[model samples]
Target: MSTRPHLLYLAWGFPPAAKSCVYRKLATANSFARAGWDVTVVTLTEDAWIREQGVDRSLLALVDPRIRVVRLPLSREDIETDIRRFSEDRALRPRTWLKRHYQQNVSHFPEATFGGWRDELVASVRRVYDERPADLLLTSGVPYTFFAPALDLFERNGLPYVLDYRDAWAIDILRDRPAFRPDSPAGLYEARLISHATEAWFVNGAIRDAYADIYPDRAQDFHVVRNGSDVAIGTDKIPMRQPGPDEPLTFGYLGTVSFSAGLTRAVCEGWRIAREANDVLRRSRLEFRGHMGVGANRGASAQAVAIAEYAKHGVSYGGPVAKADTAAVYEAWDALLLILPGGRYVTSGKVYDYVSTGLPIMSVHEWDHAAAEILSDYPLWVRNDGVEAEDVAEAFLQATKVVQGATVEDRLTARRHAEQYERYAQLRPAVERLTTRFAPGLDHVEPVGDRAPKTGEDVHRETSVPGPHAKGERVVLALTSPPSEAVRRSVALLRESGAHVELIGPDSVLEELRGLADEVITLQRATAPVKVSPSTSVTRFTPRWASVVARNLGRRHIIGPYVRVVGRSAGWWLSARRSPPAMQALKDATVLASLDDSATYLIWNASRLNTRAPARAGIGATLEELGLTRI
Candidate 1:
């Protein structure tokens, strides 16, 4: 065996996946390689990402050549766009097929989409271990399923492992509540992984505290490892130049456009208001450059459509920039638009990148957000009280002023403030701590079968943040419309009263409801069924003549679109009946309600099926039934 200690890293979204998480994952693996560990990365194949966000081949150039990467052939089926790849059932009843797929997946492991990869992950780890035992293991998540194999390895071979939650799993960080009950499958799995983990790392202090509150017993092991600016983008990119007098400013936002359409409208409305009042903004054009969405939804999301509608307001949507080209994108802008979703638990990865440019940043999220905390000390941040159009308008006005007046020294001060958040700087403490604990020649070192290193010094921990109190109740509310002020108020009251709120709605509004509800379930609507292509394996199940006929029909312009429209209409009608998960949630609900008239049918059926839980229409009536409010 080689003298160097071997490190095994399990990251599903590793490069060239084109995910924001790639920056952190790449930096981490490189950090270990630079520190003299023999690094091995196991991740999903390029095809997997191709079916999802698509790949950024440019990112692969940044990987250390010495690091060995094992790409597993794992892809998410639901995201696959090729009509030929679909099975008959997947093509015809997409929603029902997806529900069944998820049911089978979560049965094997609690995480829905990635849970089925558990066995393959275990086998991959075993193969790597058999070749040369790893001295340490690190698993990053979105697919928290990777933790399953990490824990399995630790149990079998006494391998010490780290859990890097770029975002918390058990806790819905965006909603600021437990994602699932402690007794639930996902919760139990998360708890088991944490208990056995040598270290648990979160992107920010708020997220760390959220997990710490849930697993207080393992509080000592949790650490805060913030996602900092990628060196490629921060140091390599030229700083934005201050425009001369009367120059038109370019306000830029570069990140995943994951915020809701409502948020987009609020921003555009704010931009319009600002443009009407301020000359600088009137001349300034706002450009949002990023992946608007992933998979089949890319470039066609509701947010994208909303942004397009605001083209008259000096706002435009440019497509995603390459990871290597982030600095170029930064250099083009005079000020940064830091638009993000979620409140206290979300400190977006893009915030560090924005601050690195030393450009004036306009905050378009909640005042209490974690990102706001990072920008608190920033010299040129234009603050907003909330996402309201009036607040956003004021922020735009302030940002225009900042852009017009910011001097070279002012920009330098902002950049200096962001220096502490450099990628390696944030990761150094965790890397160094692990290196010391797993140092090869230490007297504490023992045989692979018996190794259980003493708990290392607590690297970092924050005071536990108070979590939602338990009201010993669960409310499952079905919504047909995007949340209004009343719906928000009702959910807030439910959350404050310690009830777990699960909002079931169409995919279009799920993003809007995510922040208000503890759990948001998308009520699947079937789209046009994919026709089997004769060239693909799915064609094997159908007769050759049938495949040819279907292929021809799919090619006919009129037939294809008409079939799709019919499929969608049928899907919408069958949606309520086919929602097995939502139905089960309703059955288990302590109370049931509908937020709008369109949702009454689901609530009514749920009431009949779940006779014990009080079912009501409208938020006011539901609150009255729950005795939370009197009307």
Candidate 2:
């Protein structure tokens, strides 16, 4: 048997998979291997991801040759495109089959999709352990079911494991709230896993802090291991181009095009507005290079459609960029458009690479985003105040100015700013901490199981541990807009606090909020359609329309801008007026909260109409009003 201290790393999406998480996964495994630990990585077969997100062969070259990769036979059945592979049940009742499939998986373990893989994962770990006797276990999540195997190993053989949450589990990063009630099955599983783990790792501080609050006693073990750039991967050929004054600039966005269609439309609209106002921008090019969507929707997603619509205005959506070609892609661009979704919880791995490029970078996300936190000190960044078209247009103008004025010194300074976030630098401290604490042949080191498992219930029962919420409280949450991470976090806290919550939002989100809310009042979209001129009319000319348009072209153009502005405001007013349940809930609510600006006007109208309840603009304000802090 090998005498080296063995680390069995359970990563579901390790490289050759081409997912965003692969960068961190590669760096982490390599870090451990280089630290003198014999690293054995367990992951799904590359064909699994090939069937889903597709794979990049270039990433496989980056993997450390010393690290032993054990590919699992498992694949996501949902993303399978082969009709021949479909069973009779799946083919006949696909929706019902999917629901039942998820139910079966979650029944085995708390995770929905990968829970059924628990047995296979545990068997794999046991085999690895029997062969090499792993001293430590490191598991990255989503196939959080890997935690099941980790828990099994810890319970059965007194193994210590670190839980690396590339994304949060119990805390939903997208909704910015608890994913499920702490008492729920999934939450309980997370609690159990955390209590037994050697340490818990998060990609950013916000997520780490959120989890720390949930399990205060374990706060010391929670660490932030940010996903930093490899620095060397894409900088091999940083070929900087210096275009003459008359040359049109090339602005590029490189990443998975996964944001909402609304955001894409705003970007295109912003590009159009910028071109109309600026002579240089009119002739400039915006290239988006990344996977648009996976499976059947590849290149046909709503965001892809929006980008295609602006093809006449110099916006083009190229396909995915190979890992090796990343530097070359950046070489062609004068500036980078950093477009990411999610709030403070999400620090996309792309941001590090973008900043390292030393190009003029423009932020196409929220001001308070986690990526912004990293780019705060980056000198050549153009910040966006909001996701609105006007905000994006302003950012574009500012970015253009920055690009025009940028010099070699400025680029060098920007590149230097990113040195601190280089992959090994961010990861080294965490690795060293683990190395020292779990030094080889340190017989005094305590087994994780020696400490009793502390479940959420056990913590709740402790008098020293304060409860999440007060009793006999009814909070009406007006998430009239699409639910966001920030709002979702608040909702999770409210539910956990034992508050009776009445949730009012669009009908589409009812399924998502089904179990979380006490009363879900869904406001269906208005059925009445407004007659508007077809966009196709600009292409196909009709004789009667042509004469009418020619007669009042100047007058219509003058008034059309004003008309559209009024219509948008009017649309919001109309949506607010339709919800009586929302109004009544606000009146009876102990605390009324609006999650986003979409419902800010509704809350304002409600406050004036019935001033019984204290109205707050956001989840943070509501939490403060109720004197409830994360415990």
Candidate 3:
């Protein structure tokens, strides 16, 4: 074995993926390589990304040439949009074919779609161990199945592994609650992974807290490693430009527009409302410049359709801009529109880049979102209190004023505020600490001289500003619709525990739920759906016979001979279709959760509301877990 310490990194979304996660992945690999460690990155083939989110060859230029990249043959079969590639059976009954295929795959592994790749992943790890013999393993998750190999390697060779969780496993980011039941396969796997992991890294505190709360015994293992902007898009590189009198104050949104359709529509509607009300907004355009969606629907998703519909109302879609051109794009814009989905757990990776731009940002998300927490001290931020058109319209108007009146001093202050979150500043200290812990005897690597000032220690000292309602000792229960019997039972339990409970939702439901609670507040409306896609419509309103036919066709007894023949043929076809595994690591890993139920959304909303209260009990098991029940 080589004397040098070898770090094996398992990240599915590495460079060339062009996905948001690539920035962090690239930084991670480069950091390890720069630290004098032999870094090997295991990720899916380029063709896999090309088939799914598409690739950005320009991003590959950023990768440290010294670091070894192992591309696995894995690809998401579910996202294959080409009709010609589908089997006759799948072509005829796509939904049924998918269901059966998923069922078969999940039988082998816990993850529905990704379970089949477990064996390949394990084999790859074994091969890498036999050759290079890694001293340490670091796995980033979406396909948390990387833990399976990490566990395998540890059990077999006693090699330690660290989990770089960019996003949560059991905890749902969108809804801000437990994604799976504690006893479920995903939850059990997560518990096992965390229990064995030497250390667990989270992108933010909310995620860290969620994991810590779930596994109190393993709480000490979790570390906060905030996702910072790329050094390439540093504040220094971005040219600050004030809008001239003749030039309209252009508001730009530069990131993937993959949030919920409702959120996207709300932003468009808000822009229209603002434009109608303000002459400045009417003259000024709101340009959305990024990947609209993934797979076949890229640039034609519900979000893109909404943007197209609102094109007449000063909203324009500029498609995706390259990472290299991000600074130039930001410089052209006078202000930015920060539109995101979800509640407290959803701190967007784009926020760092937006902050670094030093431009006035109009927020179009929930008031209690984690982005709001990060941008609280940011000077040029104007947030919409609600998702309603009028609320967002007012925010747009406010942002317009901020942009028009923004002095050079104001811009400078914004840049100064953002200085703390520079990519290297956030990453270097954490990387150094991990390196010291794992490879103590190794000499400390010199800093990347071209990067920003070494103020990571200073930035680390600054504590996060508490939320607006952090001081308020009141329990707020927010619901999308009327409370179910289970929700009512939970509410009664909360009251019995001496908690001051206030219910907030639409006026129609608030009155009905009022008698069950101490006080009621109306939110005026529920979330409205944007344009529905054909696939969604079909899935939502599929005929009973169609399911019956699908189920029947999928059974072995109904068409045993045909199934046997097709299964063998399909297996061969799928194997051939999958790209060859590069560098002989893992070819497949498992996804954490499938999100099959509406209950996930409900639990998320309840979880967000629970965060405001001292007791922190909104859901059924959550109440019991927190021991908030009346004795």
Candidate 4:
């Protein structure tokens, strides 16, 4: 037997991945190692991270040396940085090609983009398992795709697994609904995977409630292991200095760059409120640090858009804050902005960080967010219950008053409130519990994770499931989307009439619109394609789309005839010869006019929209005019 109980930690975005999830993973692994367990993390290789978020070993500073990380040979080909490796087939129908390939990849497992890594992940875990037995396997998922390897291992070894879902697999916390259909393939995967786990961990109580609602039967395994404040906080005994007569109030936001609807709207509105309401704050500067989004959207993501819009508000994004500089940055700030997304269940990892700082905090998220819960007793919080500019502005003004009036007692009080949330402190009990469970019947076994697990997974599922779809009629709209108002309102009335309205969306999308679809392919991005052979669908065309459609139309072999390709206009068309075949193929393709205008089109022509969205819908109508819908 191993000298110490061996705990297998599976997290794709481990330290050096440069993803936001890296911090949590690092902390969790380090926490396990600190708790006397031998932690073996299974993640992607160094080169693989290079093509994705790029590498940053700085996060490993706090990592335990004893913890072993197995970097598998896997790179997300979707984010492949090597342009020279593109093939002719991959070039022509780039959009369609990736879509089709993505589907097939998921078919091999349950995830889309990373699904192809399934066999390798399983092989890696199994290889480790064979070498030395695992007492517990804790799998963290943001790339919910990481669950497969763990689930596959359970099939053979029956090793108890843990699902460390930071956000959640189901329930769009923002809109608040089932993340996916209860019956969809993705939903099926979630049900089974979560059901068998020894523990299902969530970042907050809200997320825990959601899982319990979805999988009540396995309610016994649920846990609320919050994203805690780091225990290794700044060590200066010196009291935070007061603002100088000449210096302005410097407000700061640290960690991940984000423009999530809730985060963006709240912060900007609050900024507008602060700037306009307080003469002092109008001169105050807001600086944001940390990456916006990982993968392909590094600096140019929606978060970037928010920062750009707030540029005139004396807010500037100086870039991501270095881990070493975290404490000093908070010390420099006059106050902090805690802009977050999600309602009651959404308490970000940053909340603890913000709480630990002596700065006054102005909340620009929901009144119910878990972050709000953390700040409930905090003296400096000026919570903005609304996202509107007026309400946010008032909240900002209130924050200014708090900053100005703050006493040493106030700062000490804030720090005291946050003491328990220290990353290690928050994790201590759970770590002990995990250790005990893995080393079952140990006198050291402790009942930890104060939140109840009795409200399990199975109970959550049955009550949360939307009623069965109405009887279907032919010619109804096909959908496989996770519920969203855009889709819901589109088919609300139709669905009410028993028309088979399918919703095709990913589980990451919100689920409030669950009742709007007859059936949903809830775990896949709608933009993702299902592979189809070229010979399967005919290309006969007539009507308005004729000239454009006929020239580019071709039958897809996998996703079926209803699906068609539209060019991804990434950049202005390159000289066909200079461009890769896929870029050239985009030039030759008759993508719907609207699709040609999208961000994905950047590969083909970054300046223009794909133009095919409305065009495809239009083409369908035009075919009805010719009475030739199909070849």
| lDDT by residue (tens digit), candidate 1, 1-26 | 57887899998878898788888898
Q: Rate the local accuracy (lDDT) of all candidates.
A: 0.76, 0.75, 0.68, 0.61
Point out the worst 10-residue segment of candidate 1 by lDDT. Answer: 450-459
Candidate 4: where is the Cα deviation over 4 Å? 233-239, 244-247, 261-266, 269-273, 309-312, 440-631
**lDDT score, candidate 3:** 0.68
lDDT of 3 by residue, 1-631 (tens): 4566799999889878878888888888888888878899898999788666566666787888888998889887776643334556664345677899888777766788788788998898788778788889999887777768898898899989999887887887897777789898877777778888898998888888888888999899899888876646443446556765556778899987768777878888988988888877778888988775555344445666677778788888765666765766776788888888888888888999888877898898888898887899999999888988878888988888888888877887897788788776677877787788888877778575436443322121212222212121244444445654545655665566655556544466667777876776454211122224566543533685466446445443444455355443232222222323210101121000001121122223222333332222124322332333110
**Candidate 2, poorest ten consecutive residues by summed lDDT:** 454-463
Off by over 4 Å in 1: 234-240, 440-631
Clashing pairs in 2: 174-485, 175-485, 176-485, 176-489, 177-489
Residue 604 local lDDT, model 1: 59
What TM-score would candidate 2 get against the native?
Answer: 0.70
The candidate maximizing lDDT is: 1
Off by over 4 Å in 3: 449-631
**Estimated TM-score for each candidate:** 0.71, 0.70, 0.71, 0.69
Return the TM-score for candidate 3, rounded to 2 decimals: 0.71
Clashes of each: 0, 5, 3, 73
